[model samples]
Target: MGRNTRKRRTPLATKAIAASAALALGGGGLIWANFYASAHESNSGQNQTKAAAGQVATISCPDVGQKLTNVPQRARRAVAKELANLDKQITEAYARLASTRQAQTRDANFVQNSIVGPLKEKRAASLDRIRLDIQRVGGRVNTSGLGSLAPCTTQPADQTNAGGGQNGNGGQQQGGDQQNGDGQQQGGGDQQQGGDAGQNIGGQAGNGPVAADFVDITKVAANVQGKPQNGGQASTGSFTTKCGVNANKNHNTDNVIVAPGVTNGAHHLHDYVGNQKVDAFATNDSLIQDQTSCQNQGDLSAYYWPVVRVQDGTQDFDQNADGGGKEGNVGKILTPVQAEIKYVGNPQSKVVAMPQFLRIITGDAKTTTNGLANANAHWSCTGFEDKVQLTEQYPICPQGSNVVRTFAFQSCWDGQNIDSANHRTHVAFADPASGACGNGFKAIPQLTMRLVYEITPPTLENGQVKNAYAVDGFPEQLHKPATDHDDFIAVFKNNLANKIANCINAGKQCQ
Candidate 1:
């Protein structure tokens, strides 16, 4: 007779116990699972499960092992239901802790003493009950592993605080360097200055924390104006370009670089469109050579920045004030539900060729701290153009309308420089009234992007929406509703730029 070929009934709980042992022995596991447990100490000098006065306590567990194939369907469902309840309880605890804010120092104490301590005790009791349930089902429980919880001791502000570094435009180029097809730097050299705009302030490399002193220019109401209407004449011609959705698949990974040698991609995620191969190390030549997601094959520009997330009150994104110190623990990334790109120009004048490799940042991403700069960042309801607001808090759209994020790039460019020491000096916004180019500035094909989201309007409770929508931002930002920002780069080929110019000046609408 053939050897019995039946599979053993290995319970999921047993496998989980074995996996926990394997992880302990190898010291190679998902760090985020027990990140706070090992890295942070409680005020009590005990494990993270016990806090003294003002500390953050955390509960964590290794992931359950591989799914049990031999388990009966009904039993599996029961296990899932129990696990979900536990998760919900933990999420509620976190929300309660987040809502209780006093003075920063006092708040820490209240959280550690009142919130974390009670939650830890409650979790321990729940785990004991779960162990009994698993045992009754013929499953072995890892009591020690399930009981693991930790408390985080509060450190001094200067010691534990994280801050973003100011970005300088100067750097030496490495590797085989050459100019791109558009005569822009392919590699090696300090960041070139396009005009006299000064060094790019707040241009920190990578996804680092925003500088505490950083100011957002967009929030300044004085700097912003209503959208300009056609200035000199009607458009002679126009061309429409359709770009594909955000393309950075590994945006959640911290390994991606935003600038050379800067590993800032992982702290916050960005939505990249245009170049399919953009990363921290992408170069002008590499971008030009790569395929674009845009329908206009000739248009090869890259646009990206931190993405936004809608806070519907039920989700726990780990959006702590200290910029969650743990790696890979950044909040979730939400893709844009819809995106539109368009270029417009004056009917009387030809749209001039944009300088190669020109960098433009429209909205300030760090607007949560500096409210004045928000003036330049535009937010509005789809049908309520008259209701535009400069505040970071997104307005609830009227019935039948959608939330709109509009970004209009500076249309005037210095003829010579592609970029300046500060990214802005090379490009200046057109005059608001006449839509006329500034002195010594030539008009280029105007770039504008509108992003629409289908997020439901958050209901106001006690004069505040508990979990209103928010854009992705530095960890220290607390995911404030006002911290939206966007970036753009001009990589148009000489021929394509001329074509766009011809179409606009000729009064022809060509897609």
Candidate 2:
């Protein structure tokens, strides 16, 4: 991917595994359930078999957007919209797949002939639009490789794999250069899905959050490290910004940084904090002029992330709407009890102020199927901060302990572009070992956030997880915790920006 997504590449090969994800309902209308497994420490653990005969779990396609790194800047917006359209096509097809189970059982090729084949055709059309859009902008693109991305395939929902799930780590082992240094950087093949996405395969209709996709905090090998792992040269101060936990209830399905000007671009709900007016149509000028929810009047920055929901047979206001139940995201939205946004110092050196309107997206929303190459999910719970941190699976916290979701944005900037065609090349995560920026990259006040939610612990019934909570995401994304992500845009006034940089460098914590 672009600049290797962090200085390395995996050879641009996309393999939609043969047993990746699953579907819920089966023959005779029985529901296939998702269940958690006993913790196993090694990658060679024996898997317990649960596949019913001839069951095709879920489908996956290669991520085309990550490959469009060479699209000219002039064609980016158009290409982005087309890419969003491609994702929508997949979501719609997946919904159709979920709704038509009996048909899938009657004829083995029914899914391939009626669903996947037609989807490939639809995707091919969208791919053509992308190619033409690039050509119209005087950007040449190979036509042959683009067609290969249009095909999708089915996997039997990789259930109960041996060892540390897949790739020697818990479910959905992350690609090394993903978001932050939340845990040990896993190398080699676990980055993409093969067996992990099928662990506990439970959801609206067998989407995901596989059993192995979760872990009991008591058993996880403590992977969290103490602060400032870069040693004595680090700048160790913080500046907390008190933005109430979205009490204003600002919500939308738009992503201004990635798919601006396209309504319902996200295809999933997002709870927004800080700048009050941000949507598909928002401009830098509009953001700068809009009111903010932050206590600091000078910081109009917008922060947002996918909403988490309890799948307890309840429905929210958007239950029947497009980004909600219709797209497989059905459940009540949980407002955070505490949403603390702050700027922290670089662990290796002093930081610099960021320019206004700087945009950054941390984590990958399509991690369930797109692979964990950009995954940055840091899931934990209150009162267990020192015990462990999980990047792939969600934590089933004990009673009285609320759930915690944290986001630490990329702190190193390219010193030029505020954003990029892929929205990532201009910024990168600090090296996990050295806490230093990449070549030519400069350190900026690192943005970090913590959200706390008081949710009742989900219990196991039969093989199903009752009251299970999952993050909102694309229908094809399976609502897995691996897809959890966040976004930000710096609309801060110069004075506040300077204050943040000064406080970080001076080694003084400020509000």
Candidate 3:
């Protein structure tokens, strides 16, 4: 198939043909009926385009001879069992293909290259295996049905019910001559599992920020008129806690939330920096017990989020490209030059322990267009301070300095909930003018993260560099450099929080 050629109607057409055969056979007919009806209903519009493009093909099931009258009863039973297994496997392969395809938003080429092609190969191999098994049983296996398998060409019209159904068992002929028994494939088993799994897989590809009311950093910065207030002079003691290199152990290529029960995480890939063991399935209680890579053994906090990809143009990071999703290549996973933990007294000059299970988010992951929402999602250079800007276009840092990404979370807490509905309501930024907590809020130790990367200069395309760095993000954002964001969760025990508080309040710089 050509790189741009699409096979959108093949899978559905195949399903429809299979359903017709099931109806004729009088077993498992309802299962196929339901599958065909759902698929057709969801993709009616796309089907019209598929028909016009002449991409749909007619598939016919071959006439495999019924159980041989002269064949031994035992042989008949064995063949029936083998055939049933093959049918089940074929059904499952298509079901999985449908589910995965629905989740993707990449162009036709990408579906053909990365996803559809591989799935087709697996199905073909399974069919071949089934043919061999039938030959061993002195039965002739018809291979005519194999020609219709093809790649998906068109994008699905609606994905609301993408992973809704499960593959049902194909009805098995009990005895060679007897009519096929009415076998009802169990429902609610695999369908529920697939739906839940789809939900847990991360990287939702869509337009702009997920939240409707996200605040831009530029606006926040502009609102502040004076230097950040430290409230009052620090007492005599202040302390610093440093966490050692906790390289993200769960370096998952699939960006889905793997936390227990929550399977859907990120759809696009993300570089998880801290808490090596962090995954989609991680929980507050589990994180508190996990050992810290921090030098301070008592601190067991977890911090992680998506990664930044340094795109030297020509790389297929474009979301519009055929066979492309977000960034085309996985890109390099840059380690932070430095990772540490520190607690500082809030503007009130009072250091209070952070509440356990506190979940704070810094920067907007969904800010694709607005520059203000990405103010704190900073990108800077070691020497070129004058070139810093809030736009998605990143400057080519001078030869000496590497690119730096700094994310700072809110420091004031509401003192009640460990986490709010939006992950930000419980915490608010300190007053830009006074650097003090708001009326109902209390000052807590501040958490800041700095991720440094050694990005090479952009590769020129047609005598000009168009896009240099492509940060990982939703497909709708086009992998724009500005959508970068980070997350932090406080899992410190009360005793540890108190120690951090004492260290900051006492004005001691202890690491």
TM-score of each: 0.53, 0.83, 0.51
Model 1 TM-score on a 0 to 1 scale: 0.53
Candidate topping lDDT: 2
10 residues in a row with least lDDT, candidate 2: 182-191
* Candidates in order: C-alpha RMSD to true structure: 24.5, 9.3, 23.1
Please, what are the lDDT tens digits per residue for candidate 2 over residues 141-255?
Answer: 8899988899998655543122112221222222222222200111111111112232223453345444545545554555554343645667677789887898778999889
Give lDDT per model, in order. 0.42, 0.67, 0.40
Off-target runs (Cα >4 Å) in candidate 1 are 1-236, 247-258, 313-332, 347-349, 370-375, 386-389, 480-482
User: Candidate 2, TM-score vs. the true structure?
Assistant: 0.83
Instruction: Please give, for residues 1-511, the per-residue lDDT of candidate 3 as tens digits.
Output: 0011101222432343344334323432222112111211012211100011111011111112111223232343343333333323333332333344334333435445654566456546655654565567665655655324323222221111111111110000000000000001101111211231231111112111111111112111111112343546532344555654335434443321222232223434545543455665566667777776666666677766665543222222323321123222223444566554455556555756888767776555443322222224455555432323222334355566666665546777887866542344567666544556675787787776656677664432211222234465533233434456666767665488788777877777666
Question: Which portions of model 3 miss their true places by more than 4 Å?
Answer: 1-226, 233-239, 244-249, 253-260, 312-329, 369-375, 384-391, 459-467
The true-versus-predicted C-alpha distance at residue 403 of model 2, in Å, is 0.7
Instruction: Give lDDT tens digits, candidate 1, residues 18-91.
Output: 43334323433322112111111112211111111322322222212111222232243344334434433443
TM-score (C-alpha) between model 3 and the true structure: 0.51
Candidates sorted on TM-score, descending = 2, 1, 3
